[model samples]
Target: MPIPATAPARNTKSDTDPDALSVLNHVFGLPGFRGAQEEIVRHVTGGGNCLVLMPTGGGKSLCYQLPSLLRKGCGIVVSPLIALMRDQVAGLLEAGVKAAVLNSTLSYEEASAVEARLLAGDLDLLYVAPERLLTPRCLNLLGRADVALFAIDEAHCVSQWGHDFRPEYIGLSVIAERFPDVPRIALTAPADDLTRKEIVDRLGLNNAPSFVASFDRPNIRYEIVDKQNAQSQLKAFIAERHAGDAGIVYCLSRAKVEDTAAALNKSGVEALPYHAGLDAGTRARNQDRFINEDGIVIVATVAFGMGIDKPDVRFVAHLDLPKSIEAYYQETGRAGRDGKPSSAWMAYGLSDIVQQRRMIDESTGAEAFKRVSIGKLDALVSLAETANCRRSRLLGYFGETPAAAKCGNCDNCLSPPLVRDGKVAAQKLLSCAYRTGQRFGAMHLIDILVGRLTERVTQFRHDKLSVFGIGADLNEKQWRGVIRQLVAMGHLAPDSEAFGALKLTETARGVLKGETEVMLREQVAGARIRSVRTKSRRGDIAPQIAGSGGAANPGLVGALRAWRSGVARTRGVPAYVVLHDATIDGIATSRPTTLAGLRNIPGIGDKKLEHYGDELIALVKAAG
Candidate 1:
């Protein structure tokens, strides 16, 4: 493995040039851009403002980074997360690019050194927190630097209604006024119409051309399980699908995070808890361990982390319902970023819906805001309980329609459940809600169904009603399903403030009186059966056309992947970023015998071909 000499410096005067392609190869080692990346980069590099909404792991960074390098002067990127900034800087430095980040995590001396680099024009990219950018010193530095572009990563944070809103991001429009000549690019992974509108208005990107890549991550499998012995179910999932793979388990509360992590650790899994309540050093250490160690699982709350760049996470399991579909998508998107097969499993119940809604209602927001939040929560509930394809429902929320009926990825597609005429069951459940004055949640409703003469039921004297014991035909689990389905179907709404009490909506009257028939898919009976012997643990599944490694030469491809894994493990970086799967496949198929042959691969640009061509050719020849 010989290291090639550094190539001569290239001109950075124009957006389109041989030199720009060379730098693209050198820094990121990709021959061509993916999806809308090339168009977005050209737009930004040609002195144009743009807004880009790409899915996670969809190469959003390259859109800004490549353009920043191709343009004249340094690019100032305002990122919300300090960890994300550090990760980006580390990657750039490893690529032999001059990049630095100024944030709270850095010492004064360190920040001053970066500022010195900026002033000396020795840096190509500098990441700053929006809060820090508002300071007079920072503003002065920006004014003096020959800034060519300003980029706002995670631009969705500018919206107050967004899941990860940052107040400082609201003032980021000041960058436009401060550097009118510098093109501004605002980028976010997941944002709906509301968030997008807010980003445009709040960040003042009204004039910027917008680039929205498809929000579909087709490789990911989506599953939502009912919260019945959720811990055991989670254990079974991990043991079967993600054995010995890096993953994340998200919980709603800090206590749950600690408990879940402890349980997994006790069960022989390398798991750790992460939350804001943990000491800063401990949090940092845990994050580093998860990134550096293979097969490590980090159980964390919403406060723990976001925008994590780890590519090989095989699964993301949510112990509770997330606040909204956007948050759910972002969190789930963290898994399988390397275009590998991954699963997003969520275990949620009626309690999760009520609890999430209660938290939103208790927030210091107006009635209208609370109503909007509840609507979003209801949407999430619908997504969780829907019998339709989970991937289609999820992608549809992001305004994408799937090209197929069954994605063959999610639990629904893997094992389609049976549909039953739930009209009678729905009527019984709605009657209980109305007869009980909509004062109790699914538990009490279930009790009424099974004829459980609990003290509360007797105290309310509602057990004597015709609807109380009449539903005893259905068991407890069946009754619970009915209640969940009813809520999902919009006949009943959960009263968050009243601790998940069931409230009858106008639609409930029609169903309760038998005017409208409600049909629901019956829950799979005896679906929890599992053998003591675990299935063979495979690495994350790849797309069907591209198997695990997606290579043409089985032997050489395996050797190359082993080499890549070793290199990535040693450097503590993701394997895909080093050389993407498409590049590897090209190497295996073309069997590039010369540098020129390697340079012709679609994703292997001049810089990468020059640097790695000889070693790859040698390895292929040795295998031959």
Candidate 2:
């Protein structure tokens, strides 16, 4: 059903007015708002300040976007990246909204044109970077315009303690101070209690109502693998489910990024490297290709992904552990943004943990900051080593109540391991680390417990000890999991003086003395299967992707993608910017035959329907 043409563009009616509903259906092409979207939109439209913590694909953009159209003046958005601003402005323009961006990348003529639009009150929204927005010249221009509101995206950057802290963001309070009468909104997807409070205080949004949506993204499946055969495991993982799909492979260093990209290319995956070390132009070109092309994976360090607006990223694989839980969440949230199923696959081992801790300990920051960083890393370690549902543990970190006791979407829930009374196992491991002079890391401690008389064990002649070989029952990997869990549980602490050595903490004494009962998740039957769809857990995610022997129509999806690609190429925009694969899934499922039928599809907005309705209907019919 098409939206009635008589619906007004702007309305002064109440919060529950019909005009907003019309815009929701006609402009964005959705049935209605999800979660707190309607409430936030109404508040901002009615001239109230707010802070929104919505997940990816939760339509955070519409909270400020709809208000900009209905309110008194242009919405001034202070975004962090030029790429992000450009993507947003382009999408809004395609939707027939008057949106423009002012950033360094813009040419002189382009910037002047945008300025003319701003001054002429011809634009509904103006996206600008923080540096440009804070300038004296831009401030002067904004003062002259009838500003509707101020929106600060990626608001978490203002927290000095956050992983992605931007010094320039600390000055954004000027938006609230200068535009006293105008409403303001600050938004971020992932922020803990500390980061959230800091964002409010730093952005001067203290009085604004804060709305936090559930942190659980059930559409994304989480899997953490112990780093055995890292390269082959990555290849198999990609080949199994995400073959010829767009994805990201995150590495900890630039050299690793290049090496991983090279390895992936050799293995038949079209891969590219992206990092700050490359020339600026090369980096930009690579980013553009990844965004605009299909089946291309970019191997990058943390330097990428902050301002990325691409939505159809199929997976995010971490070759190394991130600095903190917040970093991991923000990075992995990039995948499956169109609300289809995706995977967050990570390969973490003892070395990753050691390197991370050493980096924190050896950093130039204050001791207080280092302490907080270490605390954050410990939380991530817990998530990786957790025996329960991964979704529950992740959501708990962000202060959201778990959506379900077991999400049935993660590795643990899909292939639950037997939990055993690990009190004795914990005692044996802690005792070995202790009797070995408390200066050995997990490997050495495991070797000692497993009675392996390697060079280190023999050089010290420590194999003659009482605790030696007591843990022979547990294999090396199982013992490693125990040690990792022990460190995460705070019973074992990494000793700085000993250079990544494991040391018994005060909490270890209780475990050794049987005063604390330790429970550990035993290894699954065949964890080292060395395939993409390894074990029973892969079955949980197999149904999401086409050609995985599930219910999806692979041929129909392929045809729709080809059509979307041609349309996107004609418009010179990324394929997802025109239509997401999830929307393609809907078209394939419903097999809509006419323009009227296409209007009922969620992603087919007023502009898209008008532009591509005939071609889409033709394609669907031909496919049938």
TM-score of structure candidate 1:
0.89
lDDT tens digits by residue: candidate 2, 1-624: 123475466643437446676787787777778788888888888888888998876678988888877777899998998788877877776666778889998898989888988899888889999999889989999999988889999989999888899999998888878888888999988788788889999888888899888877777888888787777889988988799989999999999999899999999999999999999999988998999889899999998997688887889999999998999999999987876677899998878888888899889999999999989999999899888998899999988788568877777887777788999999988888888888888888888888999998999988999988999998988898888778778898788778868988998889988999898877588753223334333244422422122344678889998988887788877787788776687788778888888888777788888878898888888887
Highest lDDT, which number?
Answer: 2
Q: List the candidates' TM-scores in order.
A: 0.89, 0.93
Q: Give the clashing residue pairs of candidate 1, or none.
A: 31-603, 341-541
Candidate 1 per-residue lDDT, tens place, 539-622, comes to 234533212233478788887777767767776765654566556766787676778777666555544555467878898898
lDDT for every model? 0.79, 0.83
Q: Pick the candidate with the highest TM-score.
A: 2
**Local error of candidate 2 at residue 311 (angstroms):** 2.2
